[model samples]
Target chain A: MKARVFVTLKNGVLDPQGKAIANALHGLGFAGVGDVRQGKVIDIELAERDEARARATLKEMCEKLLANTVIEKYEIELQA
Target chain B: MKSAVIVFPASNCDRDAATALKQLTGQTPHMVWHRDSELPQVDLVVLPGGFSYGDYLRCGAMASQSAIMRAIKAHADRGGAVLGICNGFQVLTEAHLLPGALMRNANLQFVCRPVALEVNETQSAFTRKYEHGQRVVFPVAHGDGNYFADDETLNRLEGEGRVALRYAPGQNPNGSARDIAGILNQKRNVLGLMPHPERVVDPLLGGTDGIKLFQGLLETLS
Candidate 1:
């Protein structure tokens, strides 16, 4: 099984990197871009055969290490 | 006074912290590695600045989970003095020892410069040597030093006088909330700040305003 996790700053949190990226895009003549928020994706290859077990492990990973619940939110997707 | 400087992988400021403490106390601080589960008997524990664990995941996130933090927490629970500088501040937040998180600089650049700070409250062990509202200069060097906390927490901190220091008016270098440069925990035994006071303790280093911080701790403990 494989799992993908997306970690992003919580809503209302400032995203300076995203704002800089948006400014650079506009400077390159790419207009009409709305607010851009930056996030990170972590791809995990798991040996766990059970779908439920994989998801549970991913959640644990996010809570314990991958994401800081105080400022980040994480979503997990499991693929078999 | 006995002191210990926790050294995480890539902790570049441990030496400076050790030097500053030695200068103040006449004893070299114990250089404790992050993986050590035990701490030496000491009066102060310092988490120095550096790109710990390469600042992966988030600044200080991985470092906060190291084996040594448990001991540090135990020390803090006993009302022992603990100070976190720069990356150490981030670790304290990640470890939930302090309120709020340090976000990237508002300008998205690593800011390194001498910044003027105001002593917000001198009642704590960390700032007792300085008069309230006095201005001091310390060099801040970091990419993620902008402190953020929920409104309620900010209000509580302000009301309780837990805010130990603030950037001088119009001198906020990292957009920290209310221009906070340093804060104390509820017990006032733990302090976290972005500026490198350890780097500014010697007069030959351009200023010795930071010396009082460590000296104040020794005075309080004695």
Candidate 2:
């Protein structure tokens, strides 16, 4: 199974990098960009054939190291 | 007081911390590597600054899972003194030994300067030497020093007197929430701060405002 993780800053948390990206987009004349927030995507390959087990493992990984949970949230996707 | 300084990969302040320990405590600090699982017997453990693990994924995130962290956590659990400065502070937060997270500066720029900080709570071993509300200049050099915490956590820290240092008025270099510069854990044995007190420990090193911080730990832990 292959797992994909998306991590992003929580809604109420301050994200300076995301703000910079928004500003840069505006400077480039992309005026429609509003409240732009940035996030990271991580792909992992797992040998576990069971979808349930892979998802559980991915969730553990996300909780342990992929996401801080203090200012960020994470979503995991599994593909068998 | 006898102490040890954890040396993580890319840690640039370990030597400075050792020098400060030698000068302040008159004892050499054990330089323990991140891979080492056993922590020597010491009253205090110092985590110095610098980009650890190349700041991969997140600052201090990779290093927080280091093998030595278990021992360090054990030390903190025992109510031993643990001081994390700069990148070290990031590691402490990542390790969950301290609350809150340090985000990128609000200006999205690296801030490096001698920032004025007021000692808010001098009851902890890390700040007892300084007078409450005293102002001190400590050099801060980092890109992610903006501190953040939920309102509940913020209020609890304030109520418990766990906030040890705050930026002096108009001196918030990184826009940290509530101008918090340093904080102590619930037990007040672990302290994490973004400033580099080790850099200003000697008179010849531009200033000695950080001497009292080391002295306080020496007096309390020794």
The numbered model that scores best in TM-score is 2
Candidate 2 segments exceeding 4 Å error: none
- CAPRI-style class, candidate 2: high
Q: Per-residue lDDT of B188-218 in model 1, one digit per residue for the tens?
A: 9999999999988888998898999988998
lDDT of 2 by residue, B1-222 (tens): 889999999999999999999999999999999999999999999999999999999999999999999999999999899999999999999999999999988998898889999999999898988999999999999999999999999999999999999999999988899999999999999999999999999889899999999999999988
Query: What lDDT tens digits, residue by residue, belong to model 2 across residues A1-80?
Result: 78889999999887778889999999999978998889999999999999888888888999999999999999988866
TM-score of chain B of each: 0.99, 0.99
Error of 2 at B36 (Å): 0.6
* TM-score of chain A for the candidates in order shown: 0.96, 0.94
Candidate 1, superposed: residue stretches over 4 Å from native: none
Provide the overall lDDT of each model, using Cα atoms, as 2-decimal numbers: 0.93, 0.94
Candidate 2 positional error at B33, Å: 0.6
